[model samples]
Target: MYSSVDTIWTLLGAVLVFFMQAGFAMVETGFTRAKNAGNIIMKNLMDFSLGSLVYWILGFGLMFGATNGGFIGTPDFFVTGDYSSSIPSAALFIFQTVFCATAATIVSGAMAERTKFISYCIYSILLSAIIYPISGHWIWGGGWLSDLGFHDFAGSTAVHMVGGVSAFIGAKILGPRIGKYTKDGKVRAIPGHSLTLGALGVFILWFAWFGFNGGSTVSATGDDVLVSMASIFVTTNLAAAAAAVTTMIITWVRYKKPDVSMTLNGALGGLVAITAGCDAVSPVGAVLIGIISGFLLVASIEFIDKVLKVDDPVGAVGVHGVCGAAGTILTGVFAIDGGLLYGGGFSFLGVQILGVIAVIAWVAVTMTIVFSIINSTIGLRVSREEELAGLDIVEHGLESSYADFMPLISSEAATTTSTNDTNDTIPVKRVNSNPNAKMTKIVVITKQSKFERLKEALDKIGITGITVTQVLGCGMQKGNTEYYRGAPLETNLLPKVKVEIVVCKIPVSTVIDTVKKALYTGNIGDGKIFVYDVENVVKIRTGEEGYDALQDEAEAPSFA
Candidate 1:
């Protein structure tokens, strides 16, 4: 009777966990470029379908079938056994299958915007059917680790760790986004499209997690069951809250401002950290674990980005891998000993470390081999042309910004860029009121000292007015590199300032002359100047004519 009650509640929980695929899809697409939204959604759909179907065929039995002396289950391929009709059998397969698929989806976000659709599909199936199940068998399948009393009450190690590590490896193979790391080695902040969508997806995931941790208990009645569920809920919530605060505060202190995306990742870091021992840990323990996990996540992300030179676009490694390992280890410390709260010592802590090492080895080695095979045999990346054009139009032949392109918005991005280009081409609608149409205007990218010489050259050409902006970027000259985590992040370029000069239509050639003279400090990468045709201009403050408005700004921007 007790087993029957537990089984029913768990199956219900599986259903909730199953629905979380939608949340993952929305979050991944929202966080990446709109051009790749369709592709992202497609990968997610396939991951679950492929992961579950594969798991059902042979993965499930290996994970939880009758075991050989508690090291691993055997003879349960396709779930062929006398226990097939048992309640625990079906409930176990359903719950574990969801977790396997969830792990596979984590990679989708980290390697998004660049990975080939075929590669993603192939990896997704491998992760669920092969990667997730093998590790799951070790810990939860009554494998050797289970015999050693290794505990992962929820799947911090089995699901999150396996997924996170795979993501980290995959990201390394895929390389950074086209302009993410500049040629000079400076890391640039590439903001996601919508913060609102990212945040909303996080909230939905939080709601679904209750089912994930609660259903693991497999019971509706019993004091122990209730205690575990309530404890896990508290721990989960605390960890998420801790992570958000920790990231916000760290970023505020380091950058003098809170970074929203870091905070979002922080929340997830907290969740992954507590999953291993949520049921066993005390509420106070949860807070401490959560706080540490939150801080670890921020550090880990920076490390991975700067030091490891791994471009995890969405930071799945910090939120899942590091936090997962930390949580699983913490479980041994807190639950085994007095948990620092009940006076628990470091004995369990040692056990936790051992478990983490084993799991890491299993995942790292297997995934490396599998992915390397795919990389060597079939290319893993798409052509650079396809990436720059946006995956939607190139791959799917659909534009994500259909509305902006079709209906049109007066002040929208595309329109603004188009208007600027058109105005440049139709330049010289009328001669400058001042008869000096020969003044050459050059937009020079250089320093203040170097700029003055260009001004002198412009003076010779009768060029007038210049714009200077203090900016930082790379331009083929090697820039200073900063380390994030243990990776060497290299942009491999140099930084320079840009100077703009405007002259009469005739003197445009002179402006170029002045810039070339003033610039060129005999350095590898001093700067460059380019001229473009002028177009109609407008002054917001007053209805001013052409030259006056043109004088305000002279350079045409190459919109990225």
Candidate 2:
């Protein structure tokens, strides 16, 4: 009966863990360009599918089979023979499979936007089959790490650090995204497309982490087991919450505003840091752990980006690699049974450090070989042309995520072109206006967020037509500072929309008033509006000139 109960609990946890793959997909997609959304989603989907297949065939046995010489497992190849005499082998397999995939998927984000689909798929299989499972064997499968009194209760080292190290290696080898750095080595800020989706993904992962840490108990038979699981749940939630708050406060102080994306990553860092000792640490200890993890995440992100020069699109290395190693070491300081804070001595801390170093050494050497081979043979990164054009269209043959919008290149082109272009070949001919037949061109530069309201205001004023283009510039705000790994990246050019409308039938003052009413916010970036005298206007469709050209379908715009 106890065995059945444990099996049920494990299977439930496995399902929750499996759902994190979706969370990863959303987070990666949201933080990247819309042009690469389809490719991001596709890579995420395939990694799990490929990982599960490979783990089932070889990874499961390599991780949980009968141990040999305190190194790697030697038995239960293909999951044959009496591999499960006491528990439900199927439940164990499913639970471990999800974890294996999670580790493999972390690399996808770090090396995103510039990797070949085929190359990514191949590495995903290798990680699931050998890289992740072998190290998992060392810690969780009765191998050397377990034999040395090292405790990772829930895999800060086994899963997260493994993925984190791989992320660093992959990102390093693949190089930074185009335009991430200038010829002078100045780092640039590349903001993600959707903070809402990224935030949603963080929430989902936080919810799923309850199962991830709590279910590691792997049993629900006794009173002590139930109590432990409950405690683990509390610690996990407190740590995540504390880290998020800490990050928000720090970023607000440093950058003069709260950074939503970094705060989301902080929550993940807290979860990773606490995973190692969630079952053993008191709630107070968990809070301390979380606070420190948040600080570490911010600082590490800056250091890795600025010093190491690794371009991890999602900060996977800081959240997982640095935090994971730190969390494992902190477990030794917080664990109730043998923690230094509890009068245990430095023995456990030493063992934890040794275990971390061992795993890092093994993973780094092996991944270096794997990546070097792939980089040399089939190629690890996509060509510069493919990356600049975006992976979705060039690699996957798909349209941009927002199909209604013009191509991304067109918007970029509009930003750099002059607005003074006029075709002089055709003669300037005026039809309706003041006696002089003069015209006006109104150009408004404002926040993209205000575009809908501005357009509505124009509609209310009987203005029928206008053109808007996305652009980047600087003003009184003098741009803003973007924090990566703890480094401050100054962004001088910020995104804004340029709206242009030419009118001959309506007064220019009235058009300016309507726009000002729509976009006024009394802020530094409220934007500016320019009104230029237009000498001529010609309708391309009918060759109509001046006021006739301004009317649509032979209907003149209503004037104020």
The candidate that wins on TM-score is 2
Q: Report the C-alpha lDDT of model 2 over 345-404, residue by residue, as the tens digit.
A: 999999999999999998898898888899999999889999989999988899777777
By summed lDDT, the worst window of 10 consecutive residues in model 1 runs over 551-560
lDDT of 2: 0.86
Q: Which stretches of candidate 1 lie over 4 Å from their true place?
A: 1-4, 69-71, 82-88, 336-344, 401-405, 408-560
Model 1, 1-560: lDDT tens digits are 23666777888889878877877777777677767778787788989988888888877876777777765566466765644332556677787788888899998899888877788888888877767876788788778777776788888998899889999888887789887776776676555556776787788788888888877776778787687678778878987787789878987777666777778778878888888898888777778788888789889988888777788877888888999999998887667344544566665666678888988988888888877877777767788999887776766667674445455446677455655445433333444454333333456676545656766776665555557776666666554443322233354433456776544443455456556666666875567777765444444444444555444443422110
> TM-score for every candidate vs. truth?
0.72, 0.87
Worst 10 residues of 2 by lDDT: 426-435
Candidate 2, number of clashes? 5
Off by over 4 Å in 2: 404-438, 452-493, 502-506, 513-524, 532-560
State each model's C-alpha RMSD to the native: 9.8, 6.0
